[model samples]
Target chain A: MNLIKLAWRNIIHDPLTLFLNIILLTLGIGLINFILLLNTQLKDKFEKNLADIHMVVGAKGSPLQMILNSMYHIDAPTGNISIQEAKPFLREKHPLIDKSVPLSMGDSHKGYRIIGTDHTILEFYNAEIHAGELWNNLYDVTIGAEVAKALDLKLGSQFKSSHGFTDDVDLEHDHGTLTVVGVLKPTGSVIDQLILVSTESVWAVHDHDHEAHDHEGHEHGDHDHEEHENGHAHNDNEEHDHAHDHEGHDQHEHDHSHDDHEHDHEHDHSDPNHHHYGEIAPRRKVNDLSREHLLSQTEKDITSVLVRFKSKTNFQALNMPRNINENTDLQAASPAYEINRLYDMMGTGTKALQLLALLIAIVSAISIFVSLLNSLKRRKYELSLLRVMGGKPAKLLSLILLEGLILSLLGFFIGMIVSHLCMSAMGDSLYERYNYPFKAWIAHGKEGLLFTGTILLGLTAALLPAIMAYKTDIHSNLSEG
Target chain B: MLSTKNLSHSYKGTQAFNFPDLLCQPSETLLVIGQSGVGKSTLLHILAGILIPTKGEVLINDTSLYKQKTNALDTFRGQNIGMIFQKPHFVQAVSAVENLFLAQTMANKAKDTKRVHTLLDQLNISNRATAKTYQMSQGEQQRLSIARALVNNPKLILADEPTSALDDSNCNEVIQLLKHQAEAVNAALVIVTHDSRLKDIFPNQLELN
Candidate 1:
């Protein structure tokens, strides 16, 4: 039998102590590996999404909250600003601004926010059309790649937007159904998790409610006058087209493509042939949707604006954010500064966990040392017998050392597997809650260092006991037996 | 053949030991009988190459054992000499047969499972060959220890207090087994013991005073 076999037998013979030592070491090593996996992936995902966008302009509120709500889409928006308020920066040739794409967000479908944005938002993310054409008309929406995949949305799929970013559909805007016109390719950024639509569509859903009430009033007024005269009521309904022109509303009626929509509305009402001109009400509302509704489609507000400057080093670029913040109500937050503050906050907790894991490992190493030393003392006579049976001092030393290596190596492998299992389990819950893609099996560079360190600890722990075994006076020990 | 000349030793602040010259021919059983505190174990250790005596020349098969370097002496002892202690001790982790294998391995010899089994069968502990050494009865443990010592077919076998703790029946059986195994390998067997019961078993004797 080899020394390794002998060592293995000795370890298994006393299962309790070996198990205690291995379990202690496993907890320590597993925790260290857990921290390594989280820290590495967290840094990677944060850096990946923090590309090129330099500043966020929003209604005055928490800068970090605005960045999280706007850039990461995982927090509540600060508030919205008027289109007029953000217009100077949105222009093609503003002095300090290179590009300002406005984002209007309020409604969501299935907890995924539907962002009302121009096509330039696609350029900012460097997204391409994965399938179908871009939205060309109102009520047409484009889905991001991950959104399409996750929600199982396809081209021509229809869904109604909920009033806010929540799963509760109690406040759903069912006035119109949005058809999926396109799906954007995944850019591995926050864009992959959004639904894109035109800003006008945002207004269309909210504006329909007011216009529906106003059209009801107009329908009642004309119907009341016609029905009271009794005979002309039938003729008044036939003269509806003539009446529309005479009211100086012909331009508005001719400008709308609401013929199909009006037909559907008329079918819903029992006596609605006279309300054929209800289509004209909706047409007028679209024309004069008003700066009031446009300012905050529901609240005439956008969550935040992601801004890129003409030059980071430019003097105007430096002063522009302060100028906007002090003179106007908008606040500009740097993504870099906010994200660093975020890391510093999280780093402290992880560092503490890492230290605790290291301490556990050191204690386990001590356990291994004490166990080996204690066993050596108890087995002194046995070792001496081995020497008499033609065993050398080096051979006995090797046996002790091998026992230590087997214990620690087993602990290391089990610890690594446990750490990965924990990550995978936690990753599923995190993804379900936050839509954050966390891969569990990613091996960090420091894991190699951890493995080497553990094995070295095992060997070093055995070193002293092995030396004692080597120096045993075989004759004296054997004769004592 | 095995022989020792002018062997003596002195412990720190302890009385010195002066031992007689001794010789045993091939296939012969020599009994070195002594009382307690007579340094019989010390003499056995010095002869086994385990301890370097203050004055001694131990020659086995015409080669001087003590004339070699410490490591070389260990190697020579492993190949040519086998010693059994008073209470049979083993690497408790391994089986009886595996303990024999470990002996061969330590001696830097190729493993011989067949020889180990054969020796265990001859010693009448073949049934316990696969049992852990610690699980065996004391008599069985001693017999297995004997099998381990004889597995290598050494030139000389030294057994210290081989039957000191045994009853009459067990002591006679153990002495016969040692003599039978030693003669089978054509090696000289020297047993050091304080047990007076062994005086009648062997024809050759060396009495230490």
Candidate 2:
């Protein structure tokens, strides 16, 4: 029989001690590998979604929360700042700023955030439209890859928006269901989970909510809804006629949806804004999203403005947050700075877990050494019998060493499977909570070092026992037996 | 043939031994009897090529065992010598057939399953070939041990206290098996033990004081 087969036989025959050794080793390696997977993926995803944007300008509060809300979309916004105040940064070519995209949120569908961003977000994330075209009109929606897969949305699929970002079904907006005009390919960023539309869509939903306060009488509002469906009205005149229909009390239902049955889908209009852009009746002039719309709405606000500088060395880079924090009511947070702080705060817990895993590994090494040494004592006569026949001293030594090596390699593979299985078991709940998809198996180069280290550990543990086997007193052991 | 001349041994912390010269022709069995303090194991170790004597040489077929380098001497021992212990020690994790396989491979011989099975059948323990050594009764273990020793077709076979752990009936059965296997392989056999029951069985005997 070969030395390896002989060694394997020896290991399996003494199951209790070797089994304990393998269990400790599996737990040790499993925890270490699990931590590495979590750390790498968390760092990769956080860094990838940064997308080279330098500063986030929003209402002043916790700077970290502003960066998280604006860049990562994981937290409630600090507050909203006027769109007029962020206009200087959003201009086509400001001197210090490379580009800026304004974000307005506070609406969702089934826990996935619906963000009102224009084409700049698609350009910023380098996302391609996978199935259909980008939103051509105000309320038309372009869905992210993950959002489409999760919600089973498709081109021409329609769904109603909820008022807030949380997934409470009770807060569903009863006005109009948003239409999916496009789907974006997977970008491996936060954009993969968002439902994107023009900024006016968010304002229109809230502006309609605000118009319900101006309802004249419930009976008259119900009357206007019936006449709108019964009357043949053009898209431009429906809003003017819905003026009388707009004064609803408890039930602010208007049948403007019926007036848009003849709406066209062509995006070839020279005028950037379309008829349905302000197709809802305006209780006030601020709802006029026509030409010069943004200029006239001085009271309108956006949640945050994402700013990338023209150059890293711009004096603005050194002075931007400080300047904004001291002089303006708006807060400007650097994504890189805030994210590093987040990692440092998380590193303490990861370090403690890693230390525990290392301790388990050390204990496992001791157990392996003790187990091998114990087996060597019991197998002394057998080793001597080998020498009595034709075995060299080196062969006996290698046989002992091979047993330890074999057990350790087996434990390492089992530990790797354990780690991946654990990750997969935690995957669905983690995705439900944070919306980051974690796969069960992701291989990297670091495992190669782990393999070499395991071999070294096994050999080191077996060294003393193997030497004893090498030096076995053949005559004395055989005679003693 | 197996022979040893001037086979004496001594070391720093152990008693010195000056052994009688020994010679056994092919198909012959020799017995060396001794008390517990008479260095019976020492003589077996020197003759088995495991120990380099203070001053002596062991020969098998006219090739001096100790005259070769240490590694070559090991290969020579594997090719020429087989050993059996009194209590029938084995690599207990492996099967009886595998132990026989180990004997052949360790002795630098080609694997011969037919030779192994033939040796097992000759010992009349062929049914226990696939059983682990620990699973066998003491009598069956002793027979398997003999099968292992003869599997390599060695030039010299040494049995250390082979009948010391056996009853009178078992002792006679084992000694007969040893002599028959040695005659079958045409190798010289030597049995060293303090057991008096073996006195009448082997006629060529040496008693150490």
Total backbone collisions for each predicted model = 6, 3
**How much is A76 displaced in model 1, in angstroms?**
2.2
Residue A333 lDDT (model 1)? 83
User: Candidate 1's residue-wise lDDT over A299-386, tens digit each?
Assistant: 2345567788878778878777778888987888888789999889888998889899999999999999999998998899978777
Which portions of model 1 show Cα errors greater than 4 Å? A106-111, A135-139, A160-178, A200-299, A432-434
Docking class of 2: medium
- List the RMSD of every prediction in angstroms: 7.6, 6.8
DockQ of each: 0.66, 0.70
Q: Write model 1 residue lDDT over B117-196, tens digit each, in one string.
A: 89988999999988988889889988887887798998899998878777788888888888888999999999998777
